[model samples]
Target chain A: MKNQLTVILAILLFFGTAGFSFAVKPGEQLSDPKLEQRARTISKGLRCVVCQNQSIDDSDAELAGDMRKLVRERILAGDSDQQVKDFMVERYGNFVLMKPPLAVNTLGLWLSPVLFILIGVGLFWHVSRRKPQTKKPIDTDETEHRLEEVLNKMKKN
Target chain B: MKIQPIKFLPVIILLGIGIAFAFGLRNDPSKLASTMINKPWPDFTLERVIADQPAFSREDLHGKISLVNVFGSWCAACVQEHPMLMRLANREGVIIYGIDWRDTAEAGSAWLEKYGNPYRKVGLDANSRLAIDLGVTGAPETFLVDKNAQIRFKVVGPIDEKIWTEQLKPMIQLLQNET
Candidate 1:
């Protein structure tokens, strides 16, 4: 029982810290919860230009914080979510978007998964088709014939 | 010993992957292409860092080939690139404007005093309003604007002597020749 309690406490501590680490500071959040939520959602889709991999919402970089504030400000100014995203894309290009839009440049990136799947299926089919030929089962009649000949030789001996 | 094209597929794929990685590894991920290139410079009105100087705006850049430099007193790389900018403005007679990005007016003024000021006009960008519009990720970025007020080229990091002589010099000369 003590061991189980300790394990539970350890898991709670791990998850509690994880959640606390990624949260935006109270000072930066908007007064209206709905607008703040919208800002959070929008920020999650923006790539932090300095951090490269982290979304603006998840980054502690000063630039990301400023971007988060900008998102809220835009939201307050009656800009739709799409408009906010477009605004960022206009300034920083599509690289600012965490989810890259389907466009001429990103066609290869979007289609590569399907291409890979088709290639994988083709290889599997080719291998399976050749497998049966190499591992052909012995004929029952041949096995029986060989057994009978062995029995006859034993009888003669 | 059958010479089958299919047998070479693995080798070809391996060689292709190796070549891709070789080139990809050499690429600097931090270097982002500015979307504002060839686009008109974003509109902004900024107060002058120095009290006596007039404010800076897009109007100042009109009919001129100018270098707009973004620097911060807090940024170490900007310190490293200051002498090169001084040479360009003082020696080579380049018209350079300044944006003291994400810094206090007091700090910006003090920094200019320490490092010899090389700007025709200096604007304070305490809130990064202009920096964001220019797609600036960090400090020590420089933009070359043509006579038409279009941003022609951008350098992300600190510019050194090699970049000035090789890339920016020829580009500036080319833009100057254009009507």
Candidate 2:
């Protein structure tokens, strides 16, 4: 029981510190909750380029904090959600958008998996169809007659 | 025997993957693309680093090719690039505008005093609002603005001799010619 209690305490401590490590700097909030919500939604879709994988909303990097504040400011200034995204893109390029739009640059990235799956399915179908022909048995009578003739020739020898 | 095209499919796929990896390896993920290139410099109004100095705005950046350098006392890289900036200010004809990003006014003023102030006008970006508009990821990023107030080039890291001579100087000449 004492060992189990120690394990539980260790788990709790680990998680507690983990949570602290990722704690993002709180951005200035707008009084209008609706606008704030829109800001957050936009933030969630924008990538923190410095952090690479994390969105600005979840990243603790100073740049991410600045970006989050910018999002809020834009929303408060009455820019629409699309405008906010466009503003970020204009400053940081398409890479700043967590969900990159389907465009010429992203066409291959978005479609390659589907293309690969189709190719894989086609190969599988082709291989499955060829299996029966390769595995088909020779004529039983011909095989037996050939064996007999060979045996007879062996006896003559 | 005729070679079937189907037999070459694996090879083609492998070649495709190899080409993709080659391009991928060539890309540096850490080098963030500046989307502000060729766009007009973002408008901003910021106080000067010195208490008594006049505030600076976007208007100050126009009418000449200027180097707007984002810096801070807290940034170690800014120190590394300071001498080069001082040299440029002394030797070059272009104006160097400074944006003190995310730094205290006191620290920024002191840093300039100690390291030597190279800027024609220094703006204090205490809140970093203008820094975001300029797409500054961190301290020590520099943007070269043409006479029309358009951002022509952005350098992410500390500028040394090589960058100034090879990249920046040529661009400055081109912009100068356009004027």
Model 1, B56-146: lDDT tens digits are 7899899999999999899999999999999999999999999998888889889999998999999998777888889999989999999
lDDT of each: 0.91, 0.87
lDDT of 2 by residue, A1-157 (tens): 9999999999999988865453245436677888877877788899987788988878978778878887887787889999999988877788889998999989999999999999999999988887454565889999999999999999999
Off by over 4 Å in 2: A1-27, A31-33, A133-157, B1-12
Model 1 C-alpha lDDT versus the unseen true structure: 0.91
DockQ of each: 0.61, 0.57
**CAPRI band of model 2?**
medium
lDDT of 2 by residue, B118-176 (tens): 99888899877888787777779999999999999999989999999999999998888
Number of the predicted model whose TM-score against the real structure is largest: 1
User: What does TM-score give for chain A of every model?
Assistant: 0.79, 0.70
Error (Å) of candidate 2 at residue A30 is 3.8
Candidate 2, chain B, TM-score (2 decimals):
0.88
Count of clashes, each model? 0, 0
